[model samples]
Target: MKKTYVLDTNVLLQDPQAIFTFDEHEVVIPAIVLEEVDSKKRNMDELGRNARETSRIIDRFREAGELYKGVPLPNGGKFRIELNHRSFSKLEEIFLERTNDNRILAVALNLHLEAKKENKEVVLVSKDILMRVKADALGLKAEDFLNERAVQEDSIYDGFQEWEVGEEQLNEFYREGRLQIPEDKKKMVYPNEFIVMKNSINPSQSALGIVRSNQQVIEKCWYQEENAWGISPRNAQQIMAFELLFRQDIQLITMVGKAGTGKTLLALATGLMQVEDLGLYKKMLVARPIVPLGNDIGYLPGEKEEKLKPWMQPIYDNLEFLFDVKKSEDLDKILSGIGSIQVEALTYIRGRSIPEQLIFIDEAQNLTKHEVKTILTRVGEGSKVILLGDPQQIDHPYLDEFNNGLIHVVEKFKDYSLSGHVKLLKGERSSLAQLSADLL
Candidate 1:
């Protein structure tokens, strides 16, 4: 049966194209949602951009028909902007305040009551978890806008898999440097997926290999035990990360791990090695999202670089370690001496085509899928991009472990040969930190 989906302002801001997602179902945008969207349009961030896009989308629909009445969508659904002129007396008894959320909920509640008279299903779609809870409290159906969710947390690809094989096959793999996976196992593997081949009878005997999807074969990793810059892989996952990071064949590399998994350290070390030692790229560009904890960078009193220092301090710390500079002055001197490295904010990366550069985007979990797409599209010819993040440490309000851009790119590019991903399980920061990460 057809149902009505009431869209919350956050749903539109999270995805501007959310209006078209509910196929053949009525999509209602409350007037208060438009007011909320308009309030954010003047801001200077991704939310403002999305707010404007939402307005433009509605305006395009307005050109076709009266949006207040209803506009016929191409997908056989009707799009309408609802104005709730009804009295808030009932809501006041429950909420006791006429807040924006309560007003939006009023619109959905009114629709639900009207739909009930006609025996029609009505649901409120929102990205706000609390709003959904409120809608449910009011005896209305509510759901999350889930079109952007690429995978569930448990079902997310872990970048590596173990395959049991005969001891002879494992020996043949070591001898010939390649092994043909059986048809059943090949069906389960993806391109560039890390594979640990273990002897069927002896679990201790294992060899690490990567799947070549096109060839239907598993090949040995080239950079096993290899050091990038002065940093050596401390674990098998890090070894896989180093191989993916150093390989010119893989243009994109994504690393997901906890706080102490050396996500940024490995990327910076490999980026320095590629840009300075091997001269593989003309410059090394390191950028990260400026998601602040309390105050934004704009509130800080300093120039752009100085304002970004605190947010970018983690990047500087890794660079200082990689360059072996202990003091602040020495670190500045070393960074100035190496003119090939550029550390900037992700905001400054827009409207520029970066070519012949090795780009490292740190704290990638804090970015939306759209933001990540914009950054990736900025990569010019002969440039390689590495995204480093711990999904569990996401600061972005609308992003989570499964839906963040880091995992989105990891999942989307899993089947492609040009991209590689590694999820580091070990926390090499310290024993205390590792224990805390595990226990906490």
Candidate 2:
């Protein structure tokens, strides 16, 4: 049976090509969806970029057929814009407050009624929680645009593990500085897990084990260069980070952290130390989305780098600390030497192949899953891609803590040896920085 999907404005704004995602199912773009897109066409951030892209996509079809009528999709589906005449009538009664939410809901309700006549399923997709609630009240099937559920913010994993070891085992590990495990530690252990050993009888001999993925056997070379930026791998979170950074096997590292947790700083320091200092990689590259939190950078005069300086300043700050450059001019010299360290926007990253570089994407939490994949696919051989960001502080309105690319990458790649993740907990920025992060 074919399903009919009615997209809200938020859905299109979140992903302009969502019409093609249904995979042979009919997609309905309520007329109001276009109105919302047109209203935001002048936006300068992700929302506006999506609006213009959606307009172009719809315009391509308009050239072939009438948009109000129906156009055949390339992937065995039909797309149409539903103009709700009856919804316009009921708008006053249901949408007495004249809110945008009400108007969008009216479009869905109108589609639901028409779907009932044909005995077809009509599903409305949106990111707004309240819109789905309204659809449920109207007895219509509605869901989040991304089809991703939210995980409790507190329940987000810190990537740490604790284990109670035998008293003799603790003695052996502490005395010999390492211990071998004979049995499988599956349920009690996670891939790339960091374990803290507490003696069942003796408490003073507590030790740590950075578990290797795919097996439980303790390797001899497990604890090399554990201190990263003065933070040791004493807990699971730090161990997870070590597993990603120190390994020659994994090519991708994705980490999530709240404010003051050192996601960007750690990634930059590790990349610089490994690439330039340690001679592990040839060059270091850092990039981020320049999307504004509350405002947009519209029509800025001068070149791209100057316009991008405001957002890329954070990257330079990390580079300054890594190079130990006290003076501003000294840091500029380093940046100039490594022309390989390209500070680029996500837009320019598309349709390019990058090879043999340690690429760090700061503030990755603001990007959508599609955008992240686009950037990742650009990576060539002998390269490591590190994504670091806090999903909670995401500037993109359409994305949330779960559905954003940062979390999606972490969850999807936890099982793969080619990827690793660490959820940093301790904030080492400063006393005041930690307090503000906790209190505010």
Candidate 3:
């Protein structure tokens, strides 16, 4: 059965390649969607980039045939553009407002009626929850655009697992600091995944190890009580994070946790230590997406660094806490003395190859998978990149816990030996803050 899918403006903006995702199914684009996309094309952000890309994709299809009539897509389905001159009388009866959403709905309604004559199904694909609700109220089938969702929230990889083992095996693991995973458990572990081997008879006897899939063994974790830049791990997950962060073998590390779980602090501390103390890298580069909390305050008045001060204040705060500098003047002196740390916005990180640097991208949950790909591809030789964020605190309109770039990288790289991930569960900031995070 051939189904007709009417796409909302957000679907294309969220993913420019969405039109190709529906294999062998008719994809309908409303004229109102093009208007909305055009309105965002002039903005200077990810939305604007996606809007332009969407236009390019649509334009490329013009060589095949007229979009208004229909064009044969590569997937054996048809691509169409529905003009808004159609009658909206049916939709006006339900939704009186003349908003763009209503106009898009009117296009879908017209398509639905025409498809019903041929006994075909017409579905609306959108990322807007309210739009889907209104679509169902109008007796239309609607679904979220989930082609890029790689993992579900509940099924996300926690980077660690527990296995029951014989007492002899457990004791051997503790003594030798390495144990071969039984053939039955080999399929259950991933490269760099943490494991807790407990004695089957005595559950209290356990040993922690990380899977070395290439070596076919589980080795002891590289966790010591030593501090990195005056910051020490306070929990089991934090210890695992340090093991991943300070390792030269791991090129990519992702830390997911709540606000107070020390994700950014630990990353910054380790980056400073690696670049400054150990001279492992040339510099420590920190960057983050500029997604504002509420409405943006518009442009500021200053040069690049001065303009970035407000957005990078949180990064500076973490540095100040690490440096133990209270006065702004003193903090400037200390940072100047170090002369190897550079904090910039994610916008400027594109199109530049960064070599021999320790890069920390905070607030990565606010980025899309495409944006993260761009950032990662810029890493040159001998460079290590760390992405840290709280998936629960995303500010991106189109991103969620499962689809954000941080989680996307974590899940995609779990099987690779050069990547490591840790999800911090406990909040060690303060009792009050922990309670607020739990209750609120």
Estimate the overall C-alpha local distance difference test score of candidate 1: 0.87
TM-scores of all predicted structures: 0.96, 0.77, 0.95
Local accuracy of candidate 3 as per-residue lDDT tens digits, 361-407:
88889988888898999999999999989899988999888888888
How would you encode candidate 1's per-residue C-alpha lDDT over 157-254 as one tens digit per residue?
Answer: 78899888899999999999999878877678888889988899999999999888483999999988778778999988988898899889899998
Q: Model 2 over residues 1-440: C-alpha lDDT tens digits?
A: 78888888888887788889887888888776788899999975567888999999998998769877888999998998877646756657665775667766777778778878989888988887888988888788997765543343435555556677898887787676656655666555556555677888777767766556465543333534566545455444555576577777779888887777777776776676677667887777788886633233446766877777787888888777777789878987888887656777776777898888898888988887767788789998999999989887977778888778778787777666677677888777788998988889
Off by over 4 Å in 2: 1-6, 15-29, 35-81, 93-100, 110-124, 130-142, 146-158, 172-184, 187-190, 202-204, 220-236, 292-298, 337-340
Per-model RMSD to reference:
2.0, 4.9, 2.2
Score residue 435 of candidate 2 by CA lDDT. 90
Give lDDT for model 2. 0.75
Ranking by TM-score: 1, 3, 2
**What is the alpha-carbon lDDT for the whole of candidate 3?**
0.87
